[model samples]
Target: MRVDGLQDLATITRQLREQRERAEAEEKARREAAARLEAERQLFSRAVGQVHPLTDRNLAELPTTPPEPLPLQHWLDEERVLMESISDDFDVSSLLDTDDQLSFRRPGIGVEITRRLRSGHWSIQRQLDLHGLRVDEAREALGEFIRHAHKLGVRCVRVVHGKGLGSPGKSPVLKGRVQSWLVQKKEVLAFVQARPIDGGAGALLVLLQPARSA
Candidate 1:
């Protein structure tokens, strides 16, 4: 009976020891968490006392009013009307005539216009050079140039299609092709061979029609 009582006492003592160990482990974890929180609080307190230097001391004054929006709806309407006016079946037959020097003018375009263009009467607003570009590249460039110039109301522009000096067989290839391309575009009213000072036979002075209003 005494031995059994002693055995029960030892088991109870072991359970108590395990309980204490667990409590110690939980207490250690809580202490560590509290230490971390205290460290963070100290860091924040130090930052609160320090003054940060201003990076943008010379800041510009802000505008009082917002920018006015663009007239997007009006612009789109104008563009649609312009597109409808252009006919897909435009007669290019009149543009096919090739003179000795190679120049073209749309039908109904007076000879005086061509004469003025050749004589540098119209101011060249923009110029494009297709010196080393291939045929496909040159074609795309010319199309974009003419379209953009027409939209911007540019009346005169110069295109330098470098004389056959660098081309194979020493013949100007783009010189004739450029004329053909210009004739196809409805925006181009007339084109004449440039004068000697303005690239001569190597380039063309094109007169563009003014863009229609909305």
Candidate 2:
């Protein structure tokens, strides 16, 4: 009976020791967690990207997106782009010899535009026909688009209002709308009807004025 009692006492002592050890382990874990929290708070205060994580809103607000790229004009900063230097007297015949044609495959111009677009330096616009948009609607949309283009450092853009011949009416509605819209926007530096090799009657070359960057 004595032996059994001693054994029970030893077992109880071991169980108590385990409970004490567990309590110590929990306290240690809490201390470590507090230290980590302090470090995180310090980082949030110091780092630009590291925002306080208490609110889910901060996570959403943190910029996962890349920065705005440099403008294409910056690359050849040595060279100036003068509108006067490039001729305004563009002949339709010079670009196209036939009714069905495309000649505006100016590699030099295309390369420049592509490079600018690829570099995220400039905005390249490709608009579909204003098939359904009313004059006021088209004007409003074009105005907003041009404003955005200017902000994005877009110098040259292609506005595509498809050749209306394919549509019911012989009159080119979108083409006229684009031309009229361009005329109104002062941000438009200079634009000409696209060369035949390009979109020809269906498109216009838009030159956007740059906006002051923050």
Candidate 3:
């Protein structure tokens, strides 16, 4: 008799939960559909609108990082190097004049040196340590240079035979020999040591006079 009529509260509660879940799922689906429709509308409007080419002017939807500025010292060094390169090719130093007392010379010597310098009687300073040739070999090479320079009737010339301060103890060989050979040469007008920037004492600035009109 007790089992004849029975009602389960758990079954009733389970049915109610399913109905609420279904309603919530339907609401969520509607919201998703509305969002998708809005996105489609926006895309269609953009397609109809004039498209903008990428430019530096505006960045409404993009993120960008700023570039780093160049360092001051590096920028200055580059500028100096560029000026030096131009000077090497164009001989711009010839146009400049320094009027310091130390730089003053006899009017006659000034005129001569300026004329020769303007006429390209100069050579850039260079190190010959890499060659590592013996004194005899260097003497031979120097003789060849002298011959060639004399043949050219070059009034003035510079030879950048480097300062040899290598090893524990040794007098620089090429430097002395070069000076001696120039002294012995009858054709040599005068020779003087060069300034540091010009090649220092390692190089000699030799002057000649048009190979004696022969």
Candidate 4:
């Protein structure tokens, strides 16, 4: 009986020791995991410095209205009419004076008008520079300018059709064309080569008829 009691006591002592050891190990593991989690949180805090949330006042408003549409068809019609009104085939030599400037005066306009134009009797109200423009472009622009100026009662204007030093043969390309175009327009009364102060051979001083009362 005494030997059996001793064996039972030894087994109970061993079981208690094992339970204590397991509890100590679990506590150590829990502490180590908490320390690691705290270290990781500190590292993240250092990397992300600081942050700020945007407020409603900082937001931008979007545009509520659409842009105006272009008058594309109207422009196209105007360009077409301009193209048809002026002719490149019009002969201007018969209308020009025999002077060195090759000035022109409409029928019944008289040589006095050309002389007045050459002497700058009328102030140049507007000027169109056709340098570097293609032939078709220059023609359209010239037509539009002349019609507009005549409509607004502009008496005189300058048309600069560059001396054409850049052309294939160093000849002025738009000079003859401009003269012909001017002769065809009823609005043009006379045109004289610009004087030395106003671009010399590279431009013309044109006189437009006063606009009729509406």
Residue 129 in candidate 2 has what lDDT? Answer: 45
Per-residue lDDT of 1-214 in model 2, one digit per residue for the tens? 3546777989888999999999999999999999999998888567776555565444455677888997877756434322212222333334321223222222124434423433345444544345567656666567667767777776777776767786566777666556655655667654555666557777766656667788
Q: After aligning candidate 2 to the native by TM-score, how far in Å is the CA of 175 from where it should be?
A: 1.8
Candidate with the larger lDDT of 1 and 4: 4
Misplaced by over 4 Å in model 4 are 1-84
Among all candidates shown, the one with the greatest lDDT: 4
How do all models score by TM-score?
A: 0.55, 0.39, 0.38, 0.62
Winner of 2 and 3 under lDDT: 2
Clashing pairs in 4: none
For model 4, residues 30-58, the per-residue Cα lDDT tens digits are 99999999989899778988867667567
**C-alpha RMSD for every candidate:** 18.8, 18.4, 18.5, 17.9
Candidate 3: residue 122 Cα off by (Å): 7.3
RMSD of candidate 4 to the truth, in angstroms, is 17.9
Q: List the residue pairs that clash in candidate 1.
A: none
- RMSD after Cα superposition, model 1: 18.8
lDDT of 3 at 213: 61
- Give residue 38's lDDT in candidate 4 (0 to 100): 94
Q: State which candidate, 1 or 3, has the greater TM-score.
A: 1
Error of 3 at 210 (Å): 0.9
Error of 3 at 13 (Å): 99
Clashes of each: 0, 4, 0, 0
